[model samples]
Target chain A: GAGVSQSPSNKVTEKGKDVELRCDPISGHTALYWYRQSLGQGLEFLIYFQGNSAPDKSGLPSDRFSAERTGGSVSTLTIQRTQQEDSAVYLCASSSDYLSTDTQYFGPGTRLTVL
Target chain B: AQTVTQSQPEMSVQEAETVTLSCTYDTSENNYYLFWYKQPPSRQMILVIRQEAYKQQNATENRFSVNFQKAAKSFSLKISDSQLGDTAMYFCASSSGTYKYIFGTGTRLKVLA
Candidate 1:
């Protein structure tokens, strides 16, 4: 079975620019999540989408971070006015359901380097 | 808020040897889930094993097993007959009755040949 996949495994952008990172979840997966890994900040949950709607957006670090899932299959996380601190690995994961105990399968992650 | 902790920052083991990575968590919820994920140089997080808080017996998959102590809030991963492929950054995580998961800082394991 094909696992979750993310686009642009590595992205290098200038500060103040906006970048869109895409995530394609596995077939029939209703639960999708976005997480960030930084050198200073181990790993932090950015957002979670159950189907096409997001229920918990508190994990987002700032207002500049936003994400959307369309048709409950593909999701895009957008970051505006990128800062140096925003340089990190963006990871996407998906599960079969919205169950809390469901195991999540992760993508290779997009490494964003803000230059 | 729940917090997961992986005390060991790095660990090394010889091939075909056995190694244990320690993990502890703090949470108020009685029912939760514990997981150990291995991320190799490829950068994909792979699920090694999982343990349910309600289950007294630990979870195991092949040569990978977990020592889960609910009372002490401890969950550790043991990899037996370690191979070179076992080298990776291992993370311990928990979801305390929530849709969100809390992950640790990760332990970089090096399986030396």
Candidate 2:
């Protein structure tokens, strides 16, 4: 089976610009997750969507960060007015369900560089 | 709030030897799941092993095993007969019914030949 996939493997933008990263979860996956990993730092939870339930946006660092999952299959993370601090590797993951025991399959990640 | 901690920043073990990575987490949920993930230089995160909070028996996957101390809120991963390919960053995580996971900072392991 194909693993999670992220588009635009690398993106470079200037400060104040907006960028959208895309993620395609495995077929039939009902849960999706987004995380940010800064240089030498741990993964920072961004957001998640589960089936038809409301998405969890509590992990969004600021209002400038937002995400949307369409048809429960694909997800897009958008950063408005990006800052230099926004530069990092953005990773997406998905699982069969939201159960605690389900393994989350990760994507190769999109590295965003904000100058 | 749930929090995972990995005190060791880095560690090294000779090939064919044994190594153990320590992880501790604090969570209020009584039923949850703990996991160990390995991220290689390629930046791919792979699941190594998992342990359920309600299970008393530890989880093991071949050479990879876990010492899960529920009462102490500790979950440590042990790798025996370490191989060069085992070198990577290891992250410990915990998740409950909320479906939100808390991850540790990670421990970088280097397998020496």
**Highest-lDDT candidate:** 2
Give candidate 2 misplaced runs (Cα > 4 Å): none
The DockQ score of candidate 2 comes to 0.67
Best by DockQ: 1
Candidate 2 lDDT over residue span A23-77, tens digit each: 9999999999999998888899999899999998988999999999999999999
Look at candidate 2 and tell me the lDDT of residue A26.
94
Candidate 1: where is the Cα deviation over 4 Å?
A: none
Estimate TM-scores for all models: 0.97, 0.96
lDDT of residue B75 for candidate 1: 97
TM-score of 1: 0.97
lDDT of 1 by residue, A18-98 (tens): 999999998999999999999634579999989646457888999999998888789999999999999999999999988
What lDDT does the true structure give each of the candidates? 0.92, 0.94
- lDDT (Cα, tens digit) per residue for candidate 1, span B1-107: 79999989999999999999999999999889999999988889999999999999989999999999888999999999999999999999998777888999999
Worst 10 residues of 1 chain A by lDDT: A50-59
lDDT of 2 by residue, B1-113 (tens): 79999999999999999999999999998899999999998887889999989999999999999999998999999999999999999999998877777899999999999
Error of 1 at B12 (Å): 0.5
